[model samples]
Target: MSNSMKVSFCCKDCKRKMFDYYAGILNLYIKCNRCKRVLTLKKIDEKYVAERMINGKLFV
Candidate 1:
């Protein structure tokens, strides 16, 4: 069987669901439809983590 898993998360500013993502999938950047905020995905400690990006600054 495949080892990949599904990942789902919400927007930090709007608290709305962004989209569904697969575990092995890597998206450099994602934009929230509601708030129009940009998010960056980074792999930390072997797991994918999301962080907010504004004006070229990274916010946790």
Candidate 2:
């Protein structure tokens, strides 16, 4: 019964959450707190309720 969707982000190398909130504004230039790895997030739809990982090698 939630109107807002929750999109999660994780570290590709460590598989840990990048932020505390499940959903929030995405910043392309991000550093994973757990792994200390830099990540670039894509602009995905807000309706998606799943985690999307950026590998820096995929073609959108």
Per-prediction count of colliding residue pairs?
A: 0, 0
Count clashing pairs, candidate 2: 0
Candidate 2: global Cα-lDDT? Answer: 0.49
List where candidate 2 sits over 4 angstroms from the true fold.
1-3, 20-27, 42-60
Q: lDDT by residue for model 1 over 1-60, one digit each (tens)?
A: 034543456676877767655445454678888889988766532232333333322233
Alpha-carbon shift of residue 8 in model 2 (angstroms): 1.0
On TM-score, the candidate that comes out on top is: 1
Top lDDT model: 1
Where does candidate 2 clash, by residue pair? none
Reference-based lDDT, each prediction: 0.54, 0.49
Supply the TM-score for candidate 1: 0.51
Q: List the candidates' TM-scores in order.
A: 0.51, 0.46
lDDT of 2 by residue, 1-60 (tens): 144533345566887766433444444678867668887666544333232323312111
